[model samples]
Target: MVERVDEQDRVLAVVGRDEAVRRGWLHRIAVTVCRDREGRILVQRRSEHLARFPGHYEVASGGAVAVGESYEEAASRELAEELGVQAPVRFVVKFLNRNGLSPHWLAVHEAVLPGDPNPDPDKMMWHGWLSESELLRSMEENLFTPDSRDTLSHYFAAAERPSGQP
Candidate 1:
């Protein structure tokens, strides 16, 4: 089940994924940018059978926060489900995607999962590790989901900033 929320992120109701996406309802998603010990980023080619952005590239491994799950919990769950590994995830930031397409509240996180990720082929067609620069270059190529692109930008900017600053 999916949790549908309002502008303030308060749970308004519970619904199925199809209806939520079909109606563009506000929902919560936990996104994780898993970097290896060598600082390479994990990227994936989404399965062509998915409802949205099928066969496209994704900058991170993540998914919707279930009807009753925290952002961090969803992050860990998604990483394991999609990548088959567990790592301590740190919350980065939360932002709303209020666009016409696939609107959802994105909870961004980053982690250093220091091992090979075993991606589930049914969910992802391929997976690889790319340098941070290569991941940034991916934005220019328009190869990622809109939310992925936005979250990556936010994550990068946040990473470069010094502490005590917004």
Candidate 2:
């Protein structure tokens, strides 16, 4: 049984429909943050060995929020683990509904790195910087996770404006 915690971080007994569900504890949340330099946003190609979205492009960093960890903590950990770098993360948005998978609450963040993103081969196969136009075009031609597309759209909209606009 997975322990559920309240906003105050106190452990609470699982209850109601949440208790009846057989799926593993739904406590994990993942956040994906995409950042750009000079109109190009960093993107990572998931290793072909990935269980889902193999060989597909996705935001620079993302992973499961560990038990008792906050959304920002998970996002920062993922960024460091996947890219070997660290930067201040700014919350952009959150996505909570996905079908056919364990439910996850995602807190999207944005951050600008000092240089190119170097993907860790152990986690991702490749990385690159693509303009919003190019990313959107790719989405039109093939399949990406709905989460990716939604997050990309938000990033694109933000990038369209001048610095400090948001």
**Using TM-score as the measure, which candidate wins?**
1
State the TM-score for model 1: 0.91
lDDT of 2 by residue, 40-106 (tens): 7777778888776677777547766665667788888888888887877877755553432445455
Candidate 2 regions exceeding 4 Å error are: 1-25, 154-166
- Models 1 onward score TM values of 0.91, 0.74
Worst 10 residues of 2 by lDDT: 15-24
Q: Please provide, for model 1 over 1-166, each residue's C-alpha lDDT reduced to its tens digit, 9 standing for 90 to 100.
A: 9999999999999999778888999999898998999989888898999877888898888888997899999999998998899899999888887642678898999989879888998989988899988877876775787677788878988888898677
* Every candidate's lDDT: 0.86, 0.64
How far in Å is the alpha carbon of 48 misplaced in model 1?
2.7
List CA RMSD, all candidates: 1.7, 5.0
Q: What is candidate 2's CA lDDT for residue 93?
A: 58
